[model samples]
Target chain A: MPDLFVGVDVGGTSVKCALSGPDGKVFHEGSIPTESHEGPEAVLKRIGDYVTFLTNDIGGRPAALGMGLPGLVDAHKGISRYLPNMTTHWRDVPAAAILGRQLGCEVRLLNDVRMATYGELIYGLGKPVNTMVFIAIGTGIGGGIVIDNKLRLGPLGAAGELGHQTIDPTGPLCGCGNHGCLETLASGTALAAEGIRLMLVGMAPALHDAVDGDPGKVTVEVMGAVAEQDEPVKQAIQHAAFYIAIGVANVVVAIHPELVVIGGGVAKLGDLLLGPIRHDVRARVGRLFPVDDIRIENSQLGSKAGVLGAIALAIHGLPA
Target chain B: MPDLFVGVDVGGTSVKCALSGPDGKVFHEGSIPTESHEGPEAVLKRIGDYVTFLTNDIGGRPAALGMGLPGLVDAHKGISRYLPNMTTHWRDVPAAAILGRQLGCEVRLLNDVRMATYGELIYGLGKPVNTMVFIAIGTGIGGGIVIDNKLRLGPLGAAGELGHQTIDPTGPLCGCGNHGCLETLASGTALAAEGIRLMLVGMAPALHDAVDGDPGKVTVEVMGAVAEQDEPVKQAIQHAAFYIAIGVANVVVAIHPELVVIGGGVAKLGDLLLGPIRHDVRARVGRLFPVDDIRIENSQLGSKAGVLGAIALAIHGLPA
Candidate 1:
């Protein structure tokens, strides 16, 4: 109805498409299988088909399109590099050009977590705050830095990879090939892995029974349910939260951001996960640069963060 | 003569003052015994006298004056918050007030390292670099940051305390009450202490002869010479350099900074010190980012960095 924009989120499992107004309010949203078994061109067609559905349903084309994907994005050059587990053929994909030409809409491509940070900075809790760091700890930990209401895109666009900063040099191997990365110790995967490790050692009866001896089922969701009754599962979440809180405290001490918006599947544990993080953070918060006023909270945008943040990019970046 | 500016470098033993033109040509320079024994007012007068000499020599006060000190400096308010062992009685002294009243000139006071960073940014190797970090290994390891041609002054003006960053959680006791700080293992004080430790263990024979069994005389200078010939001292220096260079490479791989400037008293060892530091850094340079492309070198301003850096504040930080 209003001047429309299209937002696309490309994930390993699926491609999500949303048609939105210039105000970042989504009008229609839908999802389609990525079908990675098919080549990138076929998967790209599925992504394009969703965009066409939005356009056809809207009675016309959108003015702008914003896309979010898992990758080390070169926003300026419209290229993706060093992405996780995507097809090797996905290297250096001129994604914006291909999508733009097919949809006949100008497109802006951005890193998914950065786009999520954009969602918070503009439409969520961060609108009231000046400096905010958005951390999404799902499949892998990723973050985005916002200063004075603008993204701190580093010289080479590699600035906000705070997840890769080694938390413990002797820590477990990270996907980034580094050791002791915060992601290796505090992400959702870390929580689930710790739960499974404890269960394998015959530590938690309820967690062991809940997973039914399958380690794959011992996920954050299973652990969250176990935490409702079992102490071991709760402890795993507590220890993970403590590590995350300490890492957040370090960030606050170093960067002095006003707020940290934590998102991801792990965060869905809500106060159970947040309580321990807040406690540990309060205790070790650097006395020198006391970020006592720092706010730790959730992403109000919910599952729509990736799309909404891309919508923000369409609204903010493409015009520039 | 062109317009003139006054630069004051407040060191532990003496306060060096210089009069330099806007063209960065030093006109007259003098040093007075800090007589920290005489206290703040006495030293303030000595500083005032230097200001008077410069203003008078240049035929009335030419323009702005900048003072550089070695401590926590709250630059925004033009105050030196604290400097251990220096008797400025400057418990949050509004430094610009005192210096401005004395010389009838606008004044800017800053941490010595930050000033040196400013100096490098304006006229030295940092001119060609977008992101620059300068570390001065002196009584304590002090540092400053300049990125995107702007100083990275955190919310508390304590942005560049690189020395305080933890390298070893259980290393030597540091002045900040933290253990294993970079300063604890690499500063001039640390270097001298390492020499004394080796001598205590009957390891550094040359150092033992150089100091003649006097621990106080075992300075970083003597240790530098010993490290070149003495195996024990070489190992100690190599170990310390190993950590220092690792810190440099971590920052390099994370930020991919264009230039890193190493300075301070120990920089006098030049290639002897940097040669090993570079080797250790090259060893840990990560495969993830463009690490090998980073340029690591000593600060070009050298011994005159203090005064020249103060001059930098005048040129860049002065209110338009």
Candidate 2:
């Protein structure tokens, strides 16, 4: 039997696991409730048990396991530095060592978004490009950078925090404690905040109707659904795209990537958001570099990018 | 006799050249007026002539020549895409091939700032770092990025335009056609502009006295000289530092380099400007990553960085 690579993507709500062959063909997939509140030990052990059961059911021996964890990851040390959203913040947890011991296989770790970027690099749009930037615009904005056909995990293993870039110095304070970060101006959270604000002000009648006037229900989907008929919804998305474009332009000028792939929940809005970002990025960076040649497009892998990236990690080992 | 490598740094006004050994030791250096009005053909021919004369003087054959050209460069194709500062804009000129043909040696080309970064990486503070960002804050802001110990010249050979990153979305229009670029906020030109504004408004009496009340004479030096006694001059420096810090912070989060070296004329202010930038960058990025570990310092090479960087490039050839 061929050795199977196991990839695990741990999210705030659930843990996704996939078993794949050396050729990257997925053989089995499953998800389990994160129950992160039970703490890192229990969650990791459960993941170990699930993977063991998966390999046993497939009658395959596990060669290596790769896991994508959210938040600040010290990939070098196989430790989770700080996972802001996870219970107990997953601070200082030697996740890779623990998982490797439990599964009796070598375990590699990376930030979830970077894992997705690796997936994109190995299997998606970024596969053909030498240099690329992958930005995931969900509740917050996160990013991963690939240069010279290898993922760049800076000295601290915490590079590519694209959303934390300050777009407006005097803009609102960000959750990251910086004032006017790109996340504060854009991101799904920013859009939802704007949607809620518009709904509260009675400016977005369509949005109000779509969410039954519940601000808590306001999401990127609700905003997109109401955007065609709602001036305020369209304006909110344009506003987010305007700031997002600045962020993208900033990264483009900084790194000059040949391709920029946008992924995550918010990116599902597609051309409505990407069009303005594309137009604005061209206008901003056109004079400095050949902006026309830089391809900015949406990610097709969606949530699966993380698991696939983990598989790539398992197959390729750590990035140099 | 050991073959000598020739490195040339072409500027808007003057061209600096250096002959260095394979060990990166500069054997001799010379300079001549750019007289860019002579156009690309004449300027390159003169450069070839100067290399020939220099080689004859040293009794050494030219093994390879590396040049750092101002403005857009296609290092891969050895073409100058658009040298905006040059008289002809140096559009689509085959610089490397022309120089190689004249000198009977291989020629490598890179953007001036990137060459300086290469120099810093191999011969200066960046020598010890695997990942680095070198920002030269002069008449304009420019930068170079080194990833995995190699200079990253994007597909367009224009990866590091650090000064062009937008810090303010609604700030004044920049020469690059973008609004509120870091250059517009913190470059030598920006400080000079602020100094001139202060002088014209009679807010900078010390600056007025230093430049003999001439607005055209206002420079980063004049501002620094009066910064101690002039509140407005101090304010202007602080303001520029504020924005420069943002640019630094933005790059830090984007690439997470182990070192960020500041070069060019404006960096001469040293701690006065660097201090504030350091403080603000720490404050802004402290929450996102380990800011304390990232070293931000002034460039030691200063004016010779470009020439030295060219020398390093000549010795090392093109980055992979």
Candidate 3:
């Protein structure tokens, strides 16, 4: 019997494939470009190549194959439901059928953030928790909620879109078409937007000079540098962080989770981002119901969390 | 053996109690002033007296007792962790142990809102729903989350305090001392404050006259009448409703629960409040996820939800 499982993280730009053992260890891994712009067929072929590469090396002993993707997913039928950046105008593109036909093995697919949280629950900090919220702050913010060792996917599986949670209904429009979402205000996208907005208003000379006068080139890195000294950049960053901290504090007060794991690109800023968030959250939450002990940390799995999380999902509860 | 249970809803102002059979049916019920001002010892005697009245028919069948109270409670330990209003300054009072020893029966105590949601889950709107968000908009906002028919008490039994979710960090200060909490923006206290502010600012004619120019008289009832014609009152009500819609919509998008059970004294306004809340939420959430189908309604259990829910908690978590 195949003791290994195939875990795939299909992103807008790349596909990360991993051969994982039941012991929650990745035995082999490789990456392949996902030209999603070229359409699902070509992308499917790339995914197949990666999966087949690992399967062949393992003497076709992989027990199962699970793929993770961004956007709405129908895990039961193994359908894409929706892939945000894909070229396909999807209204439920069946991912399992496509991936299954390609691999001829038990293939499964799940929401990327949900998979990452599951991976964390079974293997990381969540190992000792009955509940945890996994927030990945990247181009857009998203989340996964793990309660009692299971992903609480509701009737439609639209649960855990924390980034889309309205922080300010009158603020800014999110990629999800909502206004004032925490993700649109505090994620990497928000940081970049703030940087560009500041530059447009004649702020951040170093960033302006670094990007050679092109505000679009003013990425989060430049903003972090500018925030190091520039008052305007620091204020803008603080505004978003303050709101994000309030959001976290509220989630803690409401969901009362054992841990909160934050990952994705923005977490790379380390103390610069987390410091304001921690301070604001503590101040806002009050000393009455102290959250002084709530364990908050960056994703330990780093880039491979999604892949390992998908494998964990299969081990937990993916239909054969 | 008496398979029935007695449930008590202990509030700051009054105590509502009910006798319920194992089949989820209430046999008899009554309400009395809490007079928590009299002290914890006095209140405990009152509770003992009420329990005696409930089972007096057949020399009192020494059955299980369930109690739900406002404030932070240690449900498993049957203790009041912290309650600002309950004169019991008795933090961590093991009421269950005392009552059990006094009455010769096991006792269970829970946070009032959590018990109310549990009631809804087993005997009210939360029926048929494994995942639900129960929000009660009373003098203060209180919320409870039921995941897979199980109440989520977090690690410390504080999981379902959804009223504290921050919709705005700069909005207003909540009774809990948090700024811009959902309760600060959407609860009855918010509505009352808005009404008082509007009347104090000479904004409402009908409401002003309805209360005879006394700011104290501009109650929610007077404000409701003003809403029929007064734009400021309507605007104020709608403003509260708008944020409420956002709060509920965010919960819908986050948990994707099949139903959102809304109850409380303020909900008594019915469509006057809920209509705009529903419309605003739909407008904000958009058709992307479809929340129009989410069931939002007033509590059918009236004030009896707490006790019934308490009973459900004890009976369901019984030997099985």
Candidate 4:
């Protein structure tokens, strides 16, 4: 019988789980509400229960499990340092050990976005490149770096915090306590903030009409829908894309990756978001390297990147 | 007899050559004027003659030779893409092959700053860290990245052009045609330009007196000498250090290296420059990672880093 591996991606609102074979083919997948408001122990316990039930229904014990958690992860220690978006922040949680004992299998943990990068590297568009940088733009911006075809976790396993890089020395305060970070200027949160501001001022009528005059309902999707006809919304997206392009230019100069893969919910806007980013990056980095040689594209994996990358983590183990 | 390796560091003003044993122990060293105005062929011929003379004195051929050149290098193709500081730019020159045919030995090429980084990694303070960032803050700022203890030279061999990364989006024009690159804000040239401006405005009396009221005479050393007692000079250092600290902070979040070694002529300012950089980086990056765990220090190898790194390059070959 072929050995099965379980992969789980824990998010702020849901936990996604998948069972896969050695070749990275998935046999089954499921998602459950995180109910993260219940706190770390309860959330992890529910995830563990779901995993055990899935394996039992298949009538086989998995060889190992890999879980992707949000925020600062000490992958070597199997601990989650801090998950900022979660209700309790999931500080210092021994997540891998707890799940490992429950599932009675070897378990590995990685930063959620890095797990996505691993998935993209092994199973998606990044397969052909030896060096790549993955940027995930959602509620916050996150990043992963693959150099010489190996994931670089650094000594602290906290190497790829790309969003925290200061793009503007005097921009705005960030959740990470830094000012003018890439995240503060370009993340989904930033876009939504701009949308709300524009809507409140009656500039984005399409956005205002879509949300029916409720500023709280403003989101990246709502803005993307009205972006075509709304001048202010288009400018806001362009503004965010401009800063994102600077962030991309900075990374290109720092690492000179052959490919840069943009993923996550905000990236789903496709060319609307990627076009300006691509144009600006070329203009900024054109003098340094042959900008035409580097490819910047949207991720093909979509939301599944995290869970698939988790499976890859189960197969490859921690990066050496 | 033990195998001998020859390393050459080609600079704008001079070319430094050294011969070492297999174990990297220097047996002979010499220097000659680059006289770049005489053109690429003439300069390389002079370097070849010097190497031939050195080997004749030792009565042995080196196993391999490694030459570090300024500006963009296509190391794999053995070509100098552009030597920006040189008279002719050394564009598309087959440096390694030219020297190889002359000396009848294998030759490897790298960016001069990368050569210095390799030297620091193998023979200097960078020996113990698995991941490091080397920033050379001379006339122009340059950088090298070491990941998992191997030099990361991307696909184009242009991965570590750190100074070209944009630190301020609208500050000033850089030589690379970018707006507000780190080089424009924090390099040795930037410091001297700031000193020259202050002198012209009569704000830096000591600096003006030191330079005999000549702006062209203002230099980093002159600024450093007066930094202690001269308030304006101290402010200039602090301003450059602040931006440099931001550049350091950007790399910190981008790759999270275990150590950051500052080199080149401007780094000779030591604590007068390093103190504020260290302080600002800690403040900027403290929320993301344990800044204390990442050491920021000046190079211990002084000006010899490039030649020594060229020798290491000869021993190790290009990064895989």
**Best model number under DockQ:** 2
TM-score-sorted candidate list, best first: 4, 2, 3, 1
lDDT of 4 by residue, B1-320 (tens): 44679999998899999999888899888999999999999898999999988887888777899899989899888899888898877788998888889888899999999889999999998899898999999999999998888887876678888998888888799888889999999899999999999889888888888989988899999999987767998899999999999989989988898899999999999899999999999989998878898999999897899999999889889877
- Candidates' TM-scores? 0.88, 0.96, 0.93, 0.97
The DockQ assigned to candidate 2 is: 0.80
Assess chain B of each prediction and give its TM-score: 0.93, 0.97, 0.92, 0.98
Instruction: Kindly report which residue pairs in candidate 4 clash with one another.
Output: none
Give lDDT for model 2.
0.90
Instruction: Report the C-alpha lDDT of model 2 over B188-303, residue by residue, as the tens digit.
Output: 98889988998899898888889899888888987898899899999999999999999999999988988999999999999999999899999999987788889999997887
DockQ list for all candidates: 0.28, 0.80, 0.61, 0.76
Higher DockQ: candidate 2 or 4? Answer: 2
Best of the two (1, 3) by lDDT: 3
Query: What is the TM-score, restricted to chain A, for candidate 4?
Result: 0.98
Task: List residue ranges in candidate 4 displaced over 4 A.
Answer: A1-3, B1-3
Colliding pairs, model 3 = B119-B309
Tens-digit lDDT track of model 3 for B1-320: 47667788888888887876767577787888999888776787788887876677634464787888787887777787788766656677788887777677788888889888888888888888777888888777888887777777875567777778888877687767777888888787778888888878877777878888887666676787778877999888788788778778777766787778787777777788888887877776664466766777778875777878877765665211
